[model samples]
Target: MLRYTLMRLGIFAGCLVVVWGAVYSGIFPRGFGASNGLWVLLLALVLSAPISWVVLRKERDRASVQIVTKVDRMKANLDANRSQEDVADDSARTQGQPS
Candidate 1:
């Protein structure tokens, strides 16, 4: 849980850095002064940030499903191997018994 939290924080910081850089570069032109452009940029961020968050959430969910699938496959393989060992053990025990 702590790892996940740290990872999320890192992702947020990286995103903020990228967004700040883009806005500071004056990529979006406004007829008025920089203040108006900054306002527009902030508004766009407020609006689009949720959309970006939702998209990232979806990606995280997909990655989670893949991880779960891999884990389940590993568990199933382990179970099968255990059962085979049990069968072998049982065979050996019976073979040693009196005829």
Candidate 2:
């Protein structure tokens, strides 16, 4: 988990480096007379972190819910199996009784 986290952070930092490099290299130029195309790129970069976080959170929640549902189903099946066994045992005991 730590390795995965570090890798993800590294990739995010690499993207920022590449973007800034492009701007510094004059690949991104001024536009609408106000902020510039660089401003738009920066905004997109800033937005990525929050968006990724929200998406991950939602997926984790969904996975947790699915896991809980599966566990409940398994428990219910076990209970039913136990009940069936009990019924079979009762029937056998009655059959073996002296008339």
Using TM-score as the measure, which candidate wins?
1
Tens-digit lDDT track for model 2 on 1-99?
A: 344455446556665666666666877654466666557467446755675565456555666787799999999999999999999999999999999
Candidate 1 accuracy as TM-score: 0.50
The C-alpha RMSD in Å for every predicted model, in order, reads: 9.8, 10.1
Worst 10 residues of 2 by lDDT: 1-10
Off by over 4 Å in 2: 1-55
**How far off is residue 72 in model 1, in Å?**
0.8
The TM-score obtained by model 2 is 0.48
The sequence of per-residue lDDT tens digits that candidate 1 reaches over residues 7-92 is 55565556555566665687645436757656554655565556556656756676678789999999999999999999999999
Candidates' TM-scores?
A: 0.50, 0.48
